[model samples]
Target: MGTAALVTGASSGIGRATACRLAAHGATVALLARQAEALEQVCREIRSAGGDAFVVCADLVDAVGAEQAVAQVIDRAGRLDMLINCAGAAHLSSFADDAPSQWQCMIDTNLSGTLNVSHAALSYLAAAARSDRGTADLVTVGFTAGRQSGPVTSVYAATKQAITAWSEGLRRELAPSGVRVGLIQPGLVDTPLARRLGAGPGQGLNAAVVADAIVYVVTRPAGVAVAELVVRAVGR
Candidate 1:
């Protein structure tokens, strides 16, 4: 059987691109997102390309929903070989002007959402690693702000920074179990999400560029674990 991978935020942007890329590599993909219709569209595109894909619509912010999504993937695919935690949101504003709800959305989706899905998928990843795959992957998408905080990115930066530290700890903990944990920090991406953050056209890397990096990381030799990757546009 081909490898089965679960990709969160698979409705658009990096998550959507990653799902398609993984499917192109002959992996069966499970697309997870809150938008049922959008997720279905992604699945249709994948299937039309002769790649297998299914959609799991659930809000990662809800711990129960996150767990259910993982369970659904396992139920549909029989096994999971990789998880791409790419579901995230950002709200940029000065600290003084930021509303509590906006900060809460970023925290819940970017941080808590990641935690919920990873926590729910641990055992399955471990199982996959022990099987013929020999190794399993957990890839998290962070931001350049994760490495360095900047003005107007206080809460968003905090969430990415938290992911950076959390991913490192997971890398160490899962190494012996043959599960690889990797983090990708992209400088800027031209997506709706980026536009919402006030990035102008041509300001950042394309979402496809980051998706390519993720594909590279997950497809490396089983013995080679790319623990971290930082992608920045040239001369930026």
Candidate 2:
């Protein structure tokens, strides 16, 4: 079977760059996100570059939708060797300042969304791990905010922190299964999310730079597990 990978939030930013990078490395990539038109555009770009890609448009915040999206990827891609969880939301606000809706948005998208997709893809990833590939990767796109909290981004930071802890536990749990679960903790990237949070050029890493970190994580030889990588801009 050919190597197949699934990437969430592939419509833009780090997710988009990761999907393209994985495809350029010859993995059949399934791009997942809530944006149909945007995902289709990504798919077109991948195909034009002689890479195989397909779009799976589903809201990751909904458990059922996330499961269906994973199923769709397996159905079309034949197998899933890598699952990259990049579907997340970032809302910078004080805990007391946010309305209930805003807090829920961060919790549901950043925290629960990542869980739902990872849970749905676990068995498939494990099965792939047992295949001739002999290894599988389950990656979460985390942030430095997860390691150190910011005052205004209380809720957002909490969500990232949760994912970091969850990824660690998952790494231990899936270790024997030959599934290498890892997290990419980047300091600041020039993603749509970071721009919305006021990150200026030359102040943070580029989205593709983080994507390169992800590619590095997934491409290590078998039995070599990079549990977590901290990517930060120079002199920061």
Candidate 3:
């Protein structure tokens, strides 16, 4: 009976936080991730808080799997009003030191994975905008590296940059259809992914900070569309 949202990477980090946030706001959330156990744990927390949540285990890097995930959300939730493309991977090493496989993994998970899920969900989002919510949302999680190049995060930056470009194009193209597309570019986030990427204890923003920005983007008044937002920790 409430807005239905599908959040990829809902197993942890920003995705998990966003799913909980949206659910707190009364939306029924569909949690998508490759880790069934983690996704189930998130679902339990949401349920404990009296929020509705369901899990759809998926590997976004697989196009078919991504489509199936989207389909499962539609089948289970009945409709999707928001799509949070938060699934991502990072490899932080100099270009020379990074293995080709590392580069490929970043490309596959961060870039291609986003594309696969977005492509599969566009139509459902559009339909939800037109019929149910009057405005649908597509929110992608980007990184500060995407806006400014950095040494160790070259490939990761490239993927985030691509997301920015793609989100811009989508924002313009979907404007007429009452669907809002936005990107959240965070400077640093304390997550497993960020830690693996070499973020220090004192560095980076909290994942909740980025999740708050995402909630702001998706909960805007129907007449207003927040196209992009950049969040950075103080003094960074």
Candidate 4:
């Protein structure tokens, strides 16, 4: 009977941390990811801590999988109060050096997956807004790579830039209906995805930092929407 949150990419990194954090604070969490075993483990941890959690194995890159994941959460949870579109892929290759398939994978998973889950959860979130469930919110993870052009992360940055623009537009459009849209842009987090970036001499941050920012945005009192929060390492 607590609030329900649907988190994509909930098996590891920031997604897993966010799921545990939210559930710890009394939200029923739905964990979505392609790795069934990992997702189950997170759900088990949450449940063991006396929190509510459900696991849904999904590849957010696929449209069908994205829709089905959200649908299943709604079917079981009865409603969805928050959606964390945390599903994405990380690639580190120069534009010219990168294969076309690599670029496509980044786009599909980072940009397309965000849209797919948000679109699927729209109705349920809107309904939560209409009722007394509190302000419905959508939070998407972004990166500083997308804000500036980089030598190696060109396409990855592009996908994140798309997310920033799209989320802003969504924030304005949904504000009137009591649904808030938020974006968390973190600079170089020490996640599996971040390691894939091959930071070389630079050290970013741990994924928990990003998870804390998300908790701040979603847990704030109703009527106050934290539209966007950007966190970066001090040396970065």
Candidate 5:
């Protein structure tokens, strides 16, 4: 009965936080993640909080996994009003230290996976956009890694850059169709994924911070499209 949202990577970190945030706002959230146990845990928490949630287990890196995840959400929820492309991996190492395969892995998960889910959700999102109730939306999460070249994250940065650029273009392309597309660029969120970066103690924003930003975007009025949100902790 309420607006519906699909959040990938909902097993943990930013995706889990974003799912909870949307559920708190009365949106029925579809959680997509590879870990069934952990993803179900998030769904349980949302249900316990008097919110609606469904879990669809899939590995986004695989060819058909993203589409399968979205299909399950559409089947259960009946429609998709929002999509959060939060599934991603960070391979942090010196450009020279990592093999080409590592970079490919990052590209497949962050870039190709986003495309897969977005393509599958387009029809439902388009239908929602045409509905009078609200504006349909698409959001992809990126990182500050792309904003700069660092000592050991060149490839990761490149991948994030690709996501940012792709999202921006998609936003413009979809803007006329009543579907709002945007990006959430978080700087060092304290997530399981960020832990892979090897940042020392106290070097990140809480996942809740990014989640709050997501809520702010999707909850806006129909005419209000939040183009992008660049959030970072103070002194980071």
Candidate 6:
């Protein structure tokens, strides 16, 4: 079977870049995100570049919707070879001043969202490992904040920690099934989330850098698993 990859948060930033990278590598990519217009634009970009892609606009926090979205990707692509969880939310502020709403938003979008989609795609990924590719991949984008929690990153750090923890467990559980589960920790990426933190347009590593790291992780030989990676800009 040909390669088929589903990338969450594909509307912008790292997600969008990753989807395009996977598509360019000959994977039939399914771009999943909450924004229909942005996703359609990415879809058009991919098709115009002679790459295969489709859009699946759905909130990953919604379990049923996530399941249906995964189904749509598989139905459209015929199989699922890779799943990249790049959808995320960040509320950067001191814990003393952070609101519950911010906390909830980060948890829902970062942790729960990844869980919902990975849970939905587990079986299909396992099956894909048995296909001609001989392996399947699950990748979650994490952050360095998860390791060094600072004053303004308390809650965001917690969610990323949870993601890495969950991904580690999943790696162990899926290893026997020929499924490679991995995590990417990108430090100071110049994304929408970073712009919210007041980063300039060209500051930090571009989203495409992390996208390249993701492609490297997923494209390794079946017997070699790149379980964890940390990508930082040259001067970062």
TM-scores of all predicted structures:
0.98, 0.97, 0.97, 0.95, 0.96, 0.98
| Candidate 1, residue 84: how far the Cα is off, in Å | 0.3
Model 6 lDDT, full chain set: 0.93
Name the candidate, 3 or 5, with the larger TM-score value.
Answer: 3
What are the per-residue Cα lDDT tens digits for candidate 1 across 115-203? 99999999999999999979999999999999999788989999999999999999999999999999999998998898887889878
Whole-model Cα lDDT per candidate?
A: 0.95, 0.92, 0.91, 0.88, 0.88, 0.93
Separate clash counts for every candidate: 0, 0, 0, 1, 0, 0
Off by over 4 Å in 6: none
Window of ten residues with lowest summed lDDT in model 1: 194-203
lDDT score, candidate 1? 0.95
- The model with the greater lDDT, 1 or 3, is 1
What clash pairs does model 6 have? Answer: none
lDDT of 4 by residue, 1-236 (tens): 37999998899888999899999889999999899999999999999999999999888777888889888998899899999988889878888889999999999999998898889888889888888866888999998775786888889999999999999999999998889899998888777776666654336777777888999999888899998888988967
TM-score, prediction 4: 0.95
Cα lDDT tens digits for candidate 2, 158-217: 899999999999999999999999999988788888888787765688888989999999
Candidate 5, which segments miss by more than 4 Å at Cα? Answer: 200-202
**Candidate 3, which ten residues in sequence have the lowest lDDT sum?**
194-203
What clash pairs does model 4 have? 190-205
